[model samples]
Target: MAAAVASLYRRVLPSPPAVDFASPEGKRLFAEALAAGTMEGFFPLVSCFQTQSEPAFCGLASLAVVLNALSIDPGRRWKGPWRWFDESMLDCCEPLDKVKAEGITFGKVACLARCSGANVQSFRANLATIDDLRRHLVRCVSSQDCHLIASYHRQAFKQTGTGHFSPIGGYHAGQDMALILDVARFKYPPHWVPLRLLWDAMNMTDDSTGLLRGFMLISRKTAAPSSLYTVSCRDENWKSMAKYCVEDLPNLLKGDNLDNVQTLLSRLIESLPAEAEALIKWVVEVRRKEEGDPSLSKEEKERLFLKENVLQQVRDTRLFAIVHDLQYANNPCCNCSSSSEEDSLTRIAAAVCCQGAAMLSGNLASRHGFCCKETCLKCIQANGDGLKTVISASVVSEGNEHGVDMLLPMSSPGASSCNSNLKNNVVKYPSSADVLTVLLLALHPSTWLGIKDEKLKAELQTLVSTDNLPDDLKREIMHLRRQLYYLKTCKEKEEYEDDDLPSPKWLG
Candidate 1:
């Protein structure tokens, strides 16, 4: 699946208009810079970071790039001229610095800065003095602040044609340094309690980079332990934090202790607000990624898939049910007759039937040429209404082919004599209910004339006896059986059709 997705990405990403970052040149430059370990070569990256209006996107993209790079070179430590840039780039921006000090690292700070010609030294210096600014102005400036500072700095370094750290002392440098300090202080603070909490929240520590990636994807703005500032926070930032939390799940699942991971997952799910349905979806996606195929007999893999898929479906279905209920309550008996609850119920029923059929098909595919006798027996024993519905429908269709007019609804056909015999034959010892009943029924010439086995007969009887069977399903089975019975009776009786009676299409 991963390979298929990768192939799809490759196919879709290379076309014109389909791939949009900006101008064709900009897109090319962006791709090149991404490949070259520096965003300094890309105008779009520089522009994006510089604009800084959407820090989440910039931050996420940066993290993705960094992670991709690290994945490629898992054993190597990030080093060279980029090291100083990494350390100082985010330090220059107050908000960026805060994010970093809160355990988020300068993953793409160096790359983005190198791409944009932001005055890195000056920006860093300004961090210190920026604190004294009026709260209103500071807020305004902070809101307008561009992530481009890093890109700008990177551009300067590239233009200089030197990897050496050349500190050109100036007003900008001074300002940048001040801002860096302020950001650092804002992120860490003087208080020990917050620091301890932050430390405790760090989920993973990269030994090579000495960087901490958070396990708990809680938003600093929303999770500040104060409701007073709630109105001031951006919802998007909270969502970004949630994404990080979800992205970390696969790694967390792969951790040493699975029980601990499951506990954490439960707590995370519990803590999620009702509005964060997307976050829940992301968690499901992460779980899917972490889990292996359930078909595997291996205990660990099967357990993981079962836990993940079931939990995901439960969460999704609950959300869906809630939304549906609210919508129904809000618009009780809307005049739109075409969009009725009955229609929805029918659709759900069809979906259930389709799912059952697909599952059976999958089983058949896996066991190619091997009869699913055991699985069928289990289904019979489990008596899943949905599975029973599908099996009865299938058998009705099969019986129609051989001209059997069993009047029973598709839920229960009195025990099939042939199926009973097969079951008894397969198993050494069978109860009287299981053996004698089916055998006695099978011995009858009428039952044997059309019916092949007790299983098929039982399925037909189930179809005939199902009281709540959908009208459409009933009509379909009745129509098919009528056609088959007519054909059989016509062939036996040799009655000449009157001109008024339409000739059967099959007769032609």
Candidate 2:
């Protein structure tokens, strides 16, 4: 049955476009394929990364592979299968043994081998000397296009504690300075570092709130993937990671109420070094002017000073336009409006953003106050009546109880109703009273009116007449009929209408 379902999914879903390594169009298509959820496209995409010599693409491709696998079999809870595959591909020990016979550093070769399977217990145990690992890792880092190698090194330093050369401060401070330089080189290279690293670094230092900002950065950077993206992206581990990230973020934010923008900005600024103090001071001044009571002239002077400094730095980096664009979005000069609908949408968008952010940010928000169970409870509490009605209606229609508790209104009664009727020797309806009880439960909230299933409605209508149901169900059904009729009559006579209705001006 599962195979049939999988086949049907494929039959209905079109294959992704072919990726060409030679052209920008090819890269875009590959990215699209990765984003579209095509698991099968992941390997091909990663292959493109290898050919293009673009490390960012390689890191992203690996991520896509991991994410795709998770999406397909989230229930399986697979662990580090990629590490196994990576190790098998390198087979470093055989070559290393041959090289050992020659008495060379052989660092580059060791690094390459380790990159594939650094997570493996054997690799972790063996890659002892930083120079040996750094030699290989640094080759990729210096190349600027070796994203996979860079990523592997970053992971290695993070995991194995590279003596004095940890990219991240305070981990292995007393280790060799050369090793530390290697770690730092991979981390803060002149060119683009993987966004995942930036995000992870931020999360490891800060908390859930910090992670949320990272996700917003991703959403702003990349285009969203469709169902096809999943297939093409095809890294089960990556998919799982992404899903876990997405699901966990909202729960994390909700737990601590870290929703303040000011708090977020402060955290970002705090993450910088002492050399960044001037920049931080400038940021604070600008923020104060924006939110402070100051003379117009003073505000103008402050703004001009900040702009001149920013422009100077932009020119120095030769990234003026990009900096201008970023500043434009962050600046108050941009004309943006807030609406109630926009607010609601932002909340939903934030939820989605958190998902991707959560994964790349490591498991930052996975702990803390973010509890899925709590989120579920809050969702139920917020829409108590509506959810109860929907669950009740689903239960009545499905006629089974998989695990749903009608007693707990938020419990999805549909699962219960579907499962209950399947059991052997169980009285399906129990009695007419049970039928009427379910109907009354369904009618309590306005949300039920939106349930458009004709058959479900028809089944409900059948219950309106007591004759078809068992005695107990019939009794309950009659009670509902009485209550509904009374309300209808009361409504017609205006007895339930507000007494504060005003008289017309002409009558006055």
Candidate 3:
């Protein structure tokens, strides 16, 4: 019966691509296949959007990859190559936010492409047949003329989600699959997908415009992938913006009163997920009406809002709810240790100044850098919602230096505490490093590192073997161990910079 179900699933749903698209050996095979007139390899190189901040801009992110592949600047009028990020494309193009809020439309996509100065041609049902698509896609790409993108239902390929947008780097006609370059690399790897299934997905009408899904091509004459752009993460404008976001978020989390909280929330609405933003808007309106009309005093508004709005409805938002749960879980023990005094910014400063890498210490934000091995054996896993802040903080400047790395100084108030003789300085928005380190730490560094996966598993065993954690923390530890096993053991691991967080040469 199990075998029968497996067989039936295989027949009904197209399997994901099995190619090792990340290895150097894999790179060689792919290049040879492409040069020999087969679309069977990854694009020579593409900057991945792993650890991306926004959840809904998959289409825009995929489009960014397509535009980057063609060396086309989505923001044509924008100053330098460094001036525009993949997120820059999404943020600058307001239509994308609406597409995320309302729904993605072909017209919106076309406008985004045309704004990049590319001559785009859309191919779809009846507008072009399967044979027509095969000719255009296979011939142009195989012949080294151009590349194209496909819009399809992710479930057609047995993926977990609904609609998706991704670029196709190769075509394997014998098996009849188009090699899909998924921009949501963190969620799914680059894989081969069946054309018939892709077409079926495309044939489904769009709810936004009642039109079928399709492919978009930037003509051969105008499109060519550019190699000069290293990445836009080092840009001054974006980094400065990141600094502001980092400082503001923690403060917003620490907001003491209703008025201050509202003002802070208004500033962060654009950066938040749709549900959270909408909830904030509704609550703000309630306050506006009641406070302005004299039906309630400011104090009454605050009390009513906290009880009727924040305490209940705020949790309805996916991001905020997760944050709240983690907050409660972490609040009881945040500053219990000597190393727990520094905030996120100070942690970033210590790593950058003391080690020249942007990373974080454990739960304290920064640490004293001693007794690590001894502490590791007994310390409970640093579990909290603060780890989410790392991603939130990173979202701003992840593109600032090298696509989500922050260029920060090697000095802070706590730098001397870890190492000797580092001068103190005021810190602003934490660097890209702060976000990266925290994110890596959030996963409980032991499992994320290739060298430490098994060793940490053993360490976790020892910690769990000991006595006396609160029931909630022990629950967190159990959850962490399960997740750790998955992270450490997951198959088809890509050579994403070796899954090791970036560090300074001195740290090595």
Candidate 4:
């Protein structure tokens, strides 16, 4: 009876058309690639290959395998004090529940990689030719330091699914074939696919992103901290906190009564814990450029220290004062104090910066627009002079065409001051966050007190009124609000309430 059952199952099971990696033909394909020295990337991938934990975890599993293969630090504690990349830890871009309901997009996967400390360059199929993909595959497969993940329509290969993600393990130059270390092991085995066929599959559109599915080349990030104002991307309450910034904040600051605003801000500040502080310590690299090389120049070792000092001075003079002022706003008796105006100003600035950064940083980056820490720091520093110049000019209404700048800088005396190169690279148009930051900073009661020119004060007030806002500013606000709703729907954490427990009865 068992023999009959085995024979019946064998007869009924259907075989896949693609050449299986463990099959005889597949072995020959790999052997040929190996003999041709085109399989250098295979060993590392094969050793670290993993299957998807859930039906929709192909992207996460594939990313985990590549991350581990590159030996990038996961940063958070995994099981038993081990810091490793797993499917469960790849939640930086979207919530796991949403990912389970609907798999992630190629852009989101790249976003997750960037947030998890990996460098990624993603390519969409509709944007590039088949030769372009061929070149990337050859380069990735011939190099062990980097890896490739393909997001394709499985139906293109006559497979049993729609969209799928898998790491490419090897390439056969002569056959023009690539080896897919499929993460969905239960549905499909590892197989060799024709390069053209794979490209065609990837060239199809992903319904989720309305973009063509494609590939991502991932590598490890090895750079120092970038900015003095890095945000807390790991904060779980950032979602709720950000909603308060865009929604409840306008209503809170609606009136012109200084004391009322100050009192409200003070109460809000006191209600939150110190852990709610958003801006973290900005660290600069102080170590020698190269160890055991006494000949290493002093210039090399001191590269970032000067920049760090410049940034710290700017942050303190511009943003930190606001943070310090808001922290002490809870004292009602201080409303009539000498620093009352300053405190009111700082409270508004600090609250806006904290929540603004949370909203901006929480959004996933675009596919090809991954900004590293070094780049972020450079952008902040480079924009410093332009931002300061604009603020000094006191023409906030000029922000129609060129959006308002945010990060402010202090006057520096010597060579440690901001460089001319930084001044030359001022971003033409600031983001919506920068514009909003400028508007919030303009709301400082101290700003109004110092401004004797009614025109300047009126221009500042124009920024706060929704009806008087420029079309561009209105569009940016609407765009941010839409993105907030989309993100909340996709990444919001689910909450559940505990039910009452039944009482136990004892009979003696």
| Model 4: lDDT to the true structure | 0.53
Return the candidate ranking by TM-score, descending. Answer: 4, 3, 1, 2
Q: Is candidate 1 or candidate 2 better by TM-score?
A: 1
| Candidate with the greatest lDDT versus the true structure | 4
Q: Give the number of the best model, judged by TM-score.
A: 4
Residue-level lDDT of model 4, residues 194-247, one tens digit each, is 888899998888887667888888887664222222223344565555555444
Candidate 1 TM-score to native: 0.18
Candidate 2: which stretches are off by over 4 Å? 1-122, 125-131, 147-508
Give the poorly placed runs of model 4, Cα more than 4 Å off.
Answer: 1-17, 224-322, 331-508
lDDT values, one for every candidate: 0.24, 0.24, 0.39, 0.53
In terms of lDDT, the poorest run of 10 residues in model 2 is 212-221
- Write down the TM-score of every candidate: 0.18, 0.15, 0.38, 0.52
TM-score, candidate number 4: 0.52
lDDT for model 3, on a 0 to 1 scale? 0.39
lDDT of 2: 0.24
Cα deviation of 230, candidate 1, in Å: 22
Q: What is the C-alpha RMSD of each candidate to the true structure, in Å?
A: 30.4, 31.8, 24.5, 18.2
